[model samples]
Target: MLTTRLPTKVEPYRLASSGKCLEGVIPLADMPRVVEAIGVQESDVRISLTFDIDSQRRSFIEGSISFEASLLCQRCLRPTEPEPLSSDFRLGLVTSDALAAQLPGEYEPVVVENEQLDLLSVIEDEVLLVLPQVVYHEEADCAVSRDQLASGVEPEASDAPAVNPFSVLRTLKDKH
Candidate 1:
């Protein structure tokens, strides 16, 4: 396991040729983009990646990343830990959308810029894509309930009588 900052840019051709593997922990603070999206960053992200060339001779990398993150449950407005965040991906490099579209569905398209890949951004994108679209705590765990009503000891009478619109319509119909 390599315990160091991964190269900011990687030459896919040379890396895939060697079929190298790297394992390391990316500090949570280093992933500022992910922290902004998730709203909380605490644990270091464990990353393991392997470089390879697929059968079609396309340079690609496969890897898994996992971490523990805290998220606020929208319903409860309190913190909750999501299931351990982990994901596996195989990103195939392409310089153009047309080439990316031609790739097999199993391989995610990664458009390379200037023939280099930004490894940190790739990891952050993967994590962001897998996040839950909506957050909710278990019903029993929630502090707020839909049935709860405001404290009311008595009902105050209104100065004016309430009128039903439907009754007025009914009177008009009867008169006609």
Candidate 2:
């Protein structure tokens, strides 16, 4: 989870080439927007992050994130477990003066202070970025109900039973 308390206090520096950090699974209950965004139930949430910091002028933070989640299919409204979600991106830590020069227009620059970085915020951003906009299940596994298909009646077919007018006339004469 990456965060910024004070933008100015963050000092810019190169990242360490290698490091290992792990955060326990965060409870997904309070984060309703995030859960809805990912289309996953709060119970199935899991996140694991691994990162490597580069030693360049502006060291690059490279990492892979994996998530185990379940989402509802859009068409059939069935629960689906997609292949484990994973994504990779770089974190560019820079100072106020060199912020624009170091970070390109496309890359998101995270401001750092006092040569310290918040690990949690970084992980959060990465997680959100990896989620797909729309969630859906495979067609073969979808669970649409069969009854819904049988209810639509064809316009040309009338529901009333056929009766002969001549038979009715003969029956009336016999009765008289």
| Per-prediction tally of clashes | 0, 12
Task: Write the residue-wise lDDT of candidate 1 on 54-156 in tens digits.
Answer: 8888988899988877778887778786568789999888889999999998899999888788888888887787677778777788787755534656688
At residue 109, candidate 2 shows an lDDT of: 74
TM-score of each: 0.77, 0.53
**Highest TM-score model number:** 1
**What's the lDDT for all of these models?**
0.80, 0.55
Off by over 4 Å in 2: 1-33, 39-56, 97-101, 104-108, 113-116, 145-176
* True-structure RMSD for candidate 2: 14.7
Q: How accurate is candidate 2 locally (lDDT)?
A: 0.55
lDDT of 2 by residue, 1-176 (tens): 34212121222243233444333454434345666665534443344333344443445455565666666677677667755677766666665657746676544677666677765556556667777667766555667645543668667977898777689889889998
